[model samples]
Target: MPSRVLAVYDGSGIDGDLYTRVNRWAQSAPHWLDELIKVWSAFGLGLFAVFMVLAWWRARGADSAVMARVLASPVVVVVAYGVNSVFKGAVEEIRPCAQIHGSVALETCPGTGDWSFPSNHSVIAFAAAASLWFVDRRLGWVAGLFAALMAASRVWVGVHYPHDVAAGALVGLLVAVVLTPLAGRCGPLVDRMRAGALRPLLGAGELPLVGHGHSAYRAQQY
Candidate 1:
């Protein structure tokens, strides 16, 4: 049976040409480089997970506000993915590998009904990167670079058009920008958790001692 065409937008014009060019380049690239990109395109998201765990571990020693933002990174990625899914379903854009004739993908082409307007991998990666920005600037910069590479890899692997990854990156960034600040406001909740049985997860170090009675007051404030 033929796959249904439900796309409201088609990128088989300029985007298709660009994809073809990239695919040609990939075909001539070193075997090791292609293999590396294919592997990274598939599993690079795991690095973002590691980054998040590191951020969480480091935030444990920081104030509750910082910790709250770190904790919200995963949530931001989830929300961004959900939003990107809605776009994929609505746009219904077919994968470049399927839409472009005579195109060879480094990775296996996704099957029918798997709409591919905005790349999910791109969305998750950029969302994590943006969310991490609210937690730690240096770490966020590293994640941001990885996120860009991840987006490009999707196209290099011949699964997505340039526009798809670009739109996905935009969606992930917008969602994170809007949600991360609100997430940071959950500091009071983090404080409550620290006071309860979750202290081991939230607290990384002993509270600093202030002058006499002030130490207890400061501890309660955090």
Candidate 2:
């Protein structure tokens, strides 16, 4: 279980400036790049929650079966946050922001409490993308850019390690791959329940050939 935080705590630090080599290049970026990075990071990560809610709202339509499947994906995205919770607390990996270099202009997290393991930002961002990917590959491309921005911005912000973002991305993809079809499996039952196409939402969890591999939805149906 993710350790419950009674109050805010200071973030942890790296054992040493282990990535001094990489830092050299990271510091070379102009001020505009960093500012742009921060902005993109905000959009990439922050907007994911917004997207899911919007998608959920937009998902309501004539095909309830599709809606049920589509809705299931965001639910998995929500759940993946929980899954990250378990390992994130257990791992206790320090963030890069705590490292404190002269170039990286970041402050202590103003409100977002410190708990960086698998990048929840990356996970949700990608989850949002994967959900969209299930609906349309073109939009999925945009989602991919957004997810990548979230990961890169974390590094630029000096808050999360590259590996943290990588893990988050994988987790996000995993959530979609696992959840998409699981929602689909209920298609027959959903159709039966509504007696027809009730709402026209896409299948919620990742559909095979949509995001990541595996068909958890298919497995559950039988």
Candidate 3:
């Protein structure tokens, strides 16, 4: 394992204080609620996966542009994770659970060299939420709310500092914002794929024709 970048500045100011406060609350909170957050912090990401599938299923009858974005949602999440990893490696910030003294994390502290400046869970959740926004507004809102909860849960479980989740959320949102439009541009490609052997995966329904030119094929708000 590579040497952890020693903590030149461990963000022990307000961030560490907030983490300590939350961790302290967790210690005093009801056992069931603490366990619930612990479980959610670890596994709530699965719900986002289900949301993506739901978005794809709903977009099947929409225009190719919409389908393209729905397909790209997972890709956006993967890319966001990759981007967040780069930040993690660059900062090499130690996990708060490991750095803060007298702190008790519900989740086990990650081993050394597993830097934690940006929470990977937060990145994946928010990226999925932002990508879904381009496909359907209602689904987007739901996913976005869940994303926030996921970010908070990381701190509640005492694995990440507040700044880590905030930065991760921003990275995820920005990545999706940049990539979703480019993915939307893939409508023509989706259109082509839908007509071929990929039809079963893309959708069986014929593409909806709306107006003149490409505007007819453009994705619309749902």
Candidate 4:
């Protein structure tokens, strides 16, 4: 069937045209490549979950400033999700697969009424990567790399359009940038958590503790 015609923001129908071409390309790709993209699209974000744990583990026994930043990562992600949700509601674009007739997406089409202007997967992945960057530049770069791939995978799997992922990535990065400084101001609270009963479980004794003034991005002991 011919791809369904949909109206774009400018009434140019670019969104429909691009979605059809991209979806066709994905359908024609190799079976292995298609499966790989599908797997990554479904499960790749778990890598970042591991990164979150590792970030906390490495920050154990570190100064309050560093610890605070690491702990605040999940919070930043939560806030980013909220921001993504707001954008989705405002834009209200349906999933590309839903808009296009006879779409052969690698994954099953998502249920109706789920707007797709900004991809939630991209939002979460980029948000986690961006927050981790503030904690450890090296590991942050690794997460950022995967985050980029995750964004692309969403389009490759035919669930989202390029613009949807782009908007999501922007929202995720913006959320991290806007929230990190505010999270930094909570150094004292982090210090208290470090000194409390959870210290051992948080891997405090695994490494020597470092102390410094509460400057959010204080030099690392490592």
1-222 in candidate 3: lDDT tens per residue? Answer: 546553433666647888999999989999999999998888899999999899888877777888999989999999999999988887778888888999988988997888787889999999999999988999999999999999999999888999999999999999999999899998898888888998777774444557887667744433
lDDT of 4 by residue, 1-222 (tens): 333333332211546677677778888899998998899999998998899999988887565666778888999999999988877766667787777786667898886668777899999999999889888899999999999999989888888888888889999999998887677788778656656986665534223335656733434333
Candidate with maximal TM-score = 1
What's the candidate order when arranged by decreasing lDDT?
1, 3, 4, 2
lDDT per prediction? Answer: 0.89, 0.62, 0.87, 0.80
Top candidate on lDDT is 1
TM-score per prediction, in order, is: 0.89, 0.66, 0.88, 0.83
* Lowest-sum lDDT 10-residue window in model 1: 1-10
lDDT of 1 by residue, 1-222 (tens): 434444545677747898999999999999999999999999999999999999999998888888999999998999999998888877788788988898889988998778788899999999999999988999999999999999999999999999989999999999999999999899889988998999899884335555676444445434
Candidate 2: residue 166 Cα off by (Å): 0.6
lDDT: worst 10-residue window of model 2: 7-16
- Candidate 2 structure quality by residue, lDDT tens digits, 43-142: 6566766665565565543244455556576687787778777767766555555443542434344224456666778888887788766644665677
